[model samples]
Target chain A: METQLQLLNTQGFKHTIRRLCYELIENHNTFENSIIIGLQPRGVYLSSRIVKELKEITGLSNLVNGKLDTTFYRDDFRRRSNPLIPNQTEIDFIIEDKKVILIDDVLYTGRTIRAGLDAMQAFGRPKKVELLVLIDRRYSRHLPIQPDYVGRVVDTITSDSIKVKWDEIDGQDEVLMFTDNVEKI
Target chain B: MSALSVRHLLGIKEIQASDIDLIFSTANTFKEVINRPIKKTPSLRDTTIANLFFENSTRTKLSFELAEKRLSADVINFAASSSSVSKGETLTDTVNNILAMKVDMVVMRHPYAGAAKFLSRQVKATIINAGDGAHEHPTQALLDAFSIHEKLGSIKGCNIAIIGDILHSRVALSNIFCLQKLGANVMVCGPPTLLPKYINELGVRVETNLKKALEWCDVANMLRIQLERQDIKYFPSLREYIMLYGLNMPMLESLKKEILIMHPGPINRGVEITSEVADSHQSIILNQVENGVAVRMAVMYLLAGAKQ
Candidate 1:
């Protein structure tokens, strides 16, 4: 058996997201030259939501956004038991010299962000790049990555896992924390 | 996290439908990767692949090499003609000698069928059968199916016709198995002599008339006649073969409906398919070649992570 906790409910989740959007606008100003790039799989959900919220706030319809998958760029390719399946990276517009914001649902070990930075080099050299996450697992980073805009911060041990559920995908918007069985971990 | 069911990609017949789906889905991601400006991934940075061609090849060898390089895998090329195989070194000994260099995978093309399978049994490295005799060219079939699926949205319920040299072409055998597994109706069109004796046993329709096959299929994959592999005369003359089995622009224009044209390539030019037809907008031969790298990359990527 495992212990579980509900960190944020639907109302709190909505308020948190709106707060993050306002923080983004504060930093990005008009976001005219800035683009939002969501990491693949889970990240796309949060990033898409953020993109929509940003558009609603700024009234800018042409804010560029794309999804990037880091499976090929991941450092742990063959380290795990099962093979890593890659998702589609669908960035149609040019990212050269543009300020890019990378978004994910949860920032855990920070390795994904490192991989995303490497993967972004393939598109073109961005003028600047920043990281944003709905939940940041503080002190659990394996790499030197810090999020520019964070919704919530929770200090976690190695065995603790965090999951962000969205209404669009998981039937509800909530943040859950699970303390896994030590042996299983 | 999904991996390939088999350690080696020996043949299309050896893999399941789910494996094909896995390869195609993985290839979808790789296709996008290759189209990028950088066009290189570091997934296989620590791995080394050995390209062992015991038979003559131009496209398959180069394509495998390019795929390996694009994946950032250290690659070494070996031809049987230049290697110690000509000096009577056994298959086991030659591969073992290369495996001694710590090669993680082997992409092989040999004159005998099941050579890749035999190598997998004899060695400890992942094996990819580029082409083994007239048996299976798994990657070629995969890329052909992928190109068709790309153009038509889905391969299921699509009419795909494999034409020419069915008996001596590995591409035809693999294509038949792959297309059938993907729910595509397959019809093999070739001369009576060129068609295999047990082709009907595989459950694919056999047609001797090219026009009938073309009219029936949504896509026609034109195969090259293997003149080099013909120990005895399969057809009387090239001119006669062209009249009966060749794909020409005039023949294509005669069809009431437009059909997609494809070739495994190293084309015989006017012999199997004319330059006009090969270079036409309907022909996806070049796209097939481009998809070959991505499909091969996907195969290598998946197999590289397979449980040992």
Candidate 2:
């Protein structure tokens, strides 16, 4: 966090957040029956942070603790002998009637969110599903999907990539864009 | 053994040697899958596999379900509710209803050991027994054997000790058959009451003490002691049971460092084996968990594919 916060200060992200929040509040801050759901593993943490921030900003606490394993939906199962254990996607609240805002850490190929959608149908259909990703690495759009919100717009070549480090999983918070050169790192 | 040739893997021992060869070979084909740029393939596309577990199942059901989805087969899941079975419906009826859907496969777990084997003959779809009536959980044995071969380069003459719950575990029985079939020397250990007297007929030695068994083996498979269902009073108490049969840190320290440890989890942390020993560098439980999915994928593919 110290490193990321330092980097954000240097990169001027806090300044942007201050400006963006006001713009977000002024123009687009109304929803009838909305809930935020996080994708599992790390997205669970990402969505929860967003929920807390959103609640603090808008006094909304009707956030849902939902996780999607979507291991079943991945295109490559023949390769994965033991897919990630499907964790329980517990949403006691009715999903069919709500306008759900899906939250995730990184929106790469958009496959995870696509799988999350398949998992969501089991609970019930949401009226609308808007996606929020922490980082948007503009790449191949395999599934015709786009994030409704992106915290950072990072452009990169295929070999060089944006890697996210969160304290929950990586014990630090910093988004690093690096080349995947074996010799480089 | 083409790994992806299986249709549905219901049990290990139920199938012929040809099928086992098929599963192993198929698994080997996709062995490089783990290293691929994207680890996935669509094999069981559009097929539905429901994990109808009437008992708590962790590795077996999860492995099979993952294997199915990886193959592109759709997976439906159900577990024994604390209350559902008692109110209505028999295992046969439930299984039949699932089979009636003409689903590709039904991965089942029941308290009765031979239930999966019996269900296999009756169902049109394949029935892979997760575990039943202390009869056998064939896939666990297969994965264990696979892990052994992968580590030792062969299963021949490996000293294997299956400790705890032989009287109540299908894993112990399946290991006996698979290890013997794969040419490993097998030994069974636990309290006198927990082991059947005639267990030696399965071509393995039986001993009562754990240290003796631990000292004599290259691989030790610690079975989870189901504490809730021990109505017959096998051991005097849990503390006594741990003292006698539990593999603690000291016991692990006493063993040969090269020895590979294994457990079919969710482990009874401090009971059958301590957390240190279970999570120790010696443990192959996690490896077993990994291989299980591959083995099941091999099993499922072989069962469903070759006949076609």
Q: Which stretch of 10 consecutive residues in model 2 chain B shows the poorest summed lDDT?
A: B29-38
- Can you write out model 1's per-residue Cα lDDT over B60-133, one digit (the tens) per residue? 99999999999999999999888888899999999999999999999999999889989999999999999999
Tell me how far the alpha carbon of residue B176 in candidate 1 is from the true structure, in angstroms, after superposition: 1.0
Tens digit per residue, CA lDDT, model 2, B1-308: 33332344445554555555555555654443332333454556756787888887666776777778766688888877853567797777777877777776778888875787677777777667777767878888888888777777878889999999888777888888888866789999999999988998877899998999989999999998866556778877889999999998887787765688888787988899988888888888888888787777766655554333
As for candidate 1, its interface RMSD to one decimal place is: 1.4
Would candidate 1 be rated incorrect, acceptable, medium or high by CAPRI criteria?
medium
Considering only N, C-alpha and C atoms within 3 Å, which residue pairs clash in candidate 1?
Answer: none
What digit string (tens of lDDT, one per residue) describes model 1 on residues A131-169? 999999999988889999999998788878888998987
TM-score on alpha carbons, each prediction: 0.97, 0.59
